[model samples]
Target: MNKQELIDAVAASTGESKASTGEGEGEALDAILEAVTSAVTRGEAVQLIAFGSFSTGACSERTGRNPSTGETITIPAAKTVKFTAGNSFKDAVNAA
Candidate 1:
């Protein structure tokens, strides 16, 4: 589901209100997301016990071919975000 749908579901599940400004499910989700983002951006892992962990990984510089021209090119190294689902999450998905 998209963000709005998520916000609605969260609100419904928690018996909270959805407001554009103060004390709402949307704001709470946004805050939680922002915290996770900030921590990951700082190269720290954010782990939620039954959900998953968000961490950073790296891709080394490598040679790649341009699809259209088939020309060899050097792909620069980059940082990447990685998510590993927890066992509970995996179990839920498997059950589903």
Candidate 2:
């Protein structure tokens, strides 16, 4: 689901209006999202023990082939966000 759908679901489960659910900096969901984004952007890890973890990782420059013309290209190194689901999350998904 998208952000709005997630916000709706969280708000409903918490018995709060979507707007009120996200107070202070904005909405609760938006605030959480922003916090995670900022943390990842700064190369920090955000771990929600039983849920999962988000962290930044680096990719080394590599050679790759263009799909269309089969031309070789250089893939530049870049930072990336990685997520590893926690045991509970993995179990939940597997059970389904």
Candidate 3:
């Protein structure tokens, strides 16, 4: 679901007002994003129990073909983000 839907669901479940739920959710998401960016910038990992982990990794420079031109070019190495699903989440999905 999108942000509004999420806010509505949260408000409904918690008996909170939509504005308050939205504000809290937004602040929480912003904090999470900020923390992840900060950690990744430092080449570190962020883990959330029963959800997943976010980590930084490096990509090796490689040659790749351009689909339109069929010409090969170098792709520079860069940092990458990774997410690994938690067992609980995997199990829930599988059960579904």
Candidate 4:
């Protein structure tokens, strides 16, 4: 579901007002975003249990021919982030 739906569900489940849930959710999300950003910037992994980890990898520079022009050009290496879903999360999705 979307962010608002998640906030509403949290507020309903905890018997809390939407304002409180929204504030709490926003803070929590900001923390997560900050942590992941910092880790990725340092070329580190950010892992969350029963969820997944975010990690970066490099793509080596290589030569690839253009599809249209057929001209070979060097492709620069870049960092990428990847996520591996946890077993528990996979199980929950499969069970559903």
Total clashing pairs for each candidate: 0, 2, 0, 0
Runs in model 1 deviating more than 4 A are: 20-26
Ordered from best to worst lDDT, the candidate numbers read 2, 1, 3, 4
**Lowest lDDT 10-residue stretch of candidate 4:** 23-32
Q: How displaced is residue 6 in candidate 4, in Å?
A: 4.5
TM-score of each: 0.92, 0.90, 0.79, 0.72
RMSD (Å) per prediction: 2.5, 1.9, 2.5, 2.9
**In candidate 3, which residue pairs clash?**
none
Query: Which wins on lDDT, candidate 1 or candidate 3?
Result: 1
Q: Per-residue lDDT of 30-81 in model 3, one digit per residue for the tens?
A: 5657889999789888888998888988899999999999999999999899
The parts of candidate 2 lying over 4 Å away from their true place are 22-25
Superposed model 4: Cα runs more than 4 Å off: 1-26
lDDT string, candidate 4, 17-66, tens digits: 87766665555545657879999889888888999888988889999999
lDDT of 1 at 44: 100
lDDT for residue 27 in candidate 3, whole number 0-100: 56
lDDT (10s digit) by residue, model 1, range 1-96: 988888777778777776642245557778888999999999999999999999999999999999999999999999999999999999999999
Higher-scoring candidate on lDDT, 1 or 4: 1
- Give the runs in model 3 whose Cα sits over 4 Å from its true position: 24-26
lDDT tens digits by residue: candidate 2, 1-96: 977787788888989988866644567777788899999998889999989999999999999999999999999999888999999999999999
Q: Please give the distance, in angstroms, between residue 61's alpha carbon in candidate 1 and its true position after superposition.
A: 0.2
lDDT of 4 at 48: 87
Better of 2 and 3 by TM-score: 2
